[model samples]
Target: MKKSILLFTTMFCLSLVVFAQQNKEQDESSDTVKTIEKLKYKQQPGLALAASKIFFSDKRYSISGFGEFNFIPVQNNVNPEMGDLELYYSSLYRYATFFGYRLTDKLIWNSEFQIEFLHYKTEESHYEIVIEAFFDYLFKDYLKARVGFYPLTIGYVNNNDEPVMFYSVNRSEVERLIIPSTWIEFGTMFYGNLSPSWSYALGFSQGLNSQKYISGTWIRQGREIRFDLPKSISINPQLNYTGVKNLTLSTSGYYGNSGQGEFIEISGEPVEVKGKINLTSAYAKYDWKNFRFVTVGTYGQLGDTEKLFELTKDENGENGQVLGKEVYGYLMEVGVDILPYLRKGRPIHEKQNFLFDTHEMKLSLFSRFERLNTHNKIEQSLEGLPRVESDMEIWTVGLNFNSRENIVFKANYQHRLNKFNGDQFPRKNIVETGIGFIF
Candidate 1:
């Protein structure tokens, strides 16, 4: 089934490419249209195209791709006494393809599909794909409106390509295991530069719910937690302000109610479970000559309620069934970049040329701290699923070598500590290495 779905997706994309190219040669006298026609035929579909100049052209139409691999060695001690500490492996396949075309010089459309955790083990499958699509209607250089499935504009770390930007092949453990990455869903947004160095986005999207992918035998992703909110919907608003040529500050927030799904209570009566979630974030970044720094912090809240559970009662009303409890959690992180020997012509430094330049050899040292906790509350109406809560922390450090602005190689290590009250899971320590480039 998965293979068939993948095949269909590939065929559909290829058809779009061919159709666009065929239409490009039509007798369109407009230069704007001509430019877009040229772009339609030149988009690079995979990582192999990153070095192709045609894929990076400044025409109104554009296509780009990114790919990265991560490897982690872990020491598990959560249930150490249950057994000897075990060594484990965690890796990530992060990649994305983006395409855009102009409807005029001022009106452009863009779409992107991103893939992550390409090979994480699950009871059903070791790999799964997450998709994000976008359609932007540009009004001008500073403002645009969009409708599609896109990542919520929450944090810088969540939006940027991690592999091409950082030395560590993996995201901070806080970001890795807690705050979901490549997190996207159906929605619409208003985005564009509000002013010079300043921009904003106001969007409303469908919140993630677990029931959508659950089957009779398995819960697809990893764990089967009932996020009982009906396609929990959310509203996100954010603003960015730049006071200097190389520095910008941003802040954003989210509010929504989730409906996990419908279930029956032990009392033989049916009830609906629904709750709310909220999030807020603030971040800043600075680039001064060869020095760079960035930091972001976020807070989130998950709500629980007894009224969200349900049960179907017989005429005599004898208690016979119950459902799982409610759950909630939160997370945050901060990091910085320090380049000591940044040189202009090195290969590593060359990869990031559009974003940075080497006056000297490039060196970066950075670290991040994160935290997350979730609690499940039991109700007499629900049974089987237990009330559980957990606390987790992650610390990371790394050195980045920029051979040029568009190329880099990096190595880093992390120590993760997890404490749980529901189950005796162990703490873990991990190390990672990575290399990336962009032309």
Candidate 2:
């Protein structure tokens, strides 16, 4: 079944590419219709072809920034052991500044510095810093080289997360739990377009640290702040196609060893165990008239985990690092623009005023469903070890109001269902609101 689906996706992308090329040729043969089509395409929501006007025409240098703020007014605590309702006031979710410079037509550099301030009802407030810097050398339309620290392209949101590009107050649960968002690492990458509508990226980077590979979330093992350099490496590859108008398809994966060439002392002997980790994911997006749809699925596995458990055991002679042999997650969402319907025959272009001149005001209602299991499967024969049940299902319903192509206001309600040790686990339902902008 999986093979069939893969084959169909490939064929569909190829057909779209052929169709688009034919359309382009026909448009070139005409004049009046071509102009009208170009204007219509530029008027589409979420398309920002003129954003680069801020940069020097000679393309010497450029600068940009983005920020988001969130507020949580109401929430219900589901910890049966506690009898208190939780309330989180507000927070500076993210603030980032970007810089870019072009050394020549074929060589360029880009960098970003981001700050995050997080606060919780039961946890202390803290701040985090993330930096991404890279240089790109373009050889041709089919090939380019990049080196430095940048976000790994393991999934869609990891590299393409702009504030106005998504419809949620917060990112999806699958992206946060299954694959780390804004997960950056030092690496060398090669990427470019394979055809007019298809592209690919491949890279190698530093691997994760097994010592921090806990049971509930393996992604936390990322060596973001290690004092020493990583001895092992990871390979990442991705393929993307946007042949069809308003449609996109992508697939990506990562493979590597997280052991960092460490030796474990077991039974009075030094033993070497290479703990391997593998992950793969695929996603698709389609926009039709007033409705939009998106879906994504991912799977991950770890090898030699039983030996890793022994090496990272707790002080009580018990293995606390019972890493799962398998983990998986998926999410699906749908959204619709309701402002057109509410206006009763008034077109989007007519609703624009001076403040919203270059963009049309939009109101969208969206819903997302997600499921994930960190402990989908575990190693057997580990005597007296308790099973870890980290399965969860989540539901989010939200509304997004876009004042412009680069600014938005969002509100959402989120519900979580958790399972632990084969029983229902207490969780929370939250009401969240936020505003985000980019320039």
Candidate 3:
């Protein structure tokens, strides 16, 4: 752990040094701002970089930010349904200032330090500050390697941040609360193009226990049970293929295991419980210039051994036994763009004109569905819930307005249903509106 931390520090310092050198070079090359070179951003990551390259010839210093506010008003009966509502937002929200800089042509650093209320609550608190800062090496024109605290590159939505692109003002509620966006952890990764129309990325990241809760105390062979902390690792791989000029398809998968060690007291003696979790997932997506479709599915299981047991003085003593359970889930989404009908405002293939005419606006209608099942004892016990299965289905249909790749406006109506305990949750619905931008 010490060595890893040191290495990260050293790399960060080295990148700073390189950035200074590049700044000096830029100063010597030109005194005043000039039109940006066309291919300067061909090797860059996204629109932010490309836009910054346009404003600041020096890649060493770049500035960018985005802000958004969402409102959800519920109308109907007095008792608010408990299911599917946790995913919806009721008031003010924002993901602002996010900034990044290219230390050198081969290395870049980015951060998504955030400030927002938890579910639009009145109280405020610090969320995660350090988003992602890593050293990337461009091995070839299309291949790259990165290491540091970065979001896992699993699905299309997982890889995209709020500012650059998103199908909705907020991500699918299923993915937002469950999968966690801007979810970063220490890890290493490799990304490159497989062919002209296909690209791929592979990486490994620290894993966490999937159990939702904890019950009685457990010890592992005389030692107190310490919940799993970076004990397991995750494997993520993705493949993207461009089927046509405007259509793209992608598939990705993730597999991991979580490890926890514990110790318990049995009739005056110390006992132990070591739990292991296995998780796996696969997803596919299709993007056509203005329309999109996606499907994702995942499965996980937890296993552990009883190892020891105690009984009353006159009661029969029990031997150690093993306990385990399996859980599974899946999600799907489909949407279409309405901006295609908004009349093409400009020709992208043509030369640059005024700022407003340089890009076009697009709108889309989308829907998403999700489900989860925990049918075994191991799962129920681990989550501190009964052995009852829980599943949720949400339907969202909305319109999104995106203009010049910088500003976005959205409005959507959502209806969600929960299926559990043989009682179908009442259909809950809400209307949401939002605005966001990137620089």
TM-score of 1: 0.66
Candidate 1 regions exceeding 4 Å error are 1-57, 74-89, 117-125, 176-178, 210-232, 260-266, 305-361, 375-390, 421-427, 437-439
Question: Could you give me the TM-score of model 3 versus the true structure?
Answer: 0.66
Error of 2 at 111 (Å): 0.7
Clashing pairs in 2: none
| Whole-model lDDT per candidate | 0.49, 0.67, 0.50
Q: Model 2 over residues 48-97: C-alpha lDDT tens digits?
A: 21222122324466555556767665233333222111112233366666
Alpha-carbon deviation at 402 in model 3, angstroms: 2.3
lDDT by residue (1-439, candidate 1, tens digit) is: 3453355356435534543452354456654343232222221211123312233456656654455545554344333332111113344445555666666655555565555443222212234455545565656656667676666677665665435554466654333333344356567788777667677888887664433211110111212222243355678888888767877788887677554454546477765545455667677777676555666565555443344322222356532222223322333333344443342354453322323445424667766665644323345444343322235566777777666444466777767675654454434566777655442
TM-score of each: 0.66, 0.78, 0.66
Per residue, candidate 3 scores C-alpha lDDT tens digits across 344-427 of 574455332222223455667887766654433443323442222244566777777765455567888766665555332333
User: What is candidate 1's CA lDDT for residue 310?
Assistant: 21
**Model 2: residues with Cα > 4 Å off, grouped in runs:** 1-58, 73-92, 221-229, 310-319, 347-358, 381-389, 421-426
Model 3 segments more than 4 A misplaced: 1-58, 74-89, 120-130, 141-143, 209-230, 243-247, 260-277, 302-329, 340-359, 372-390, 422-427
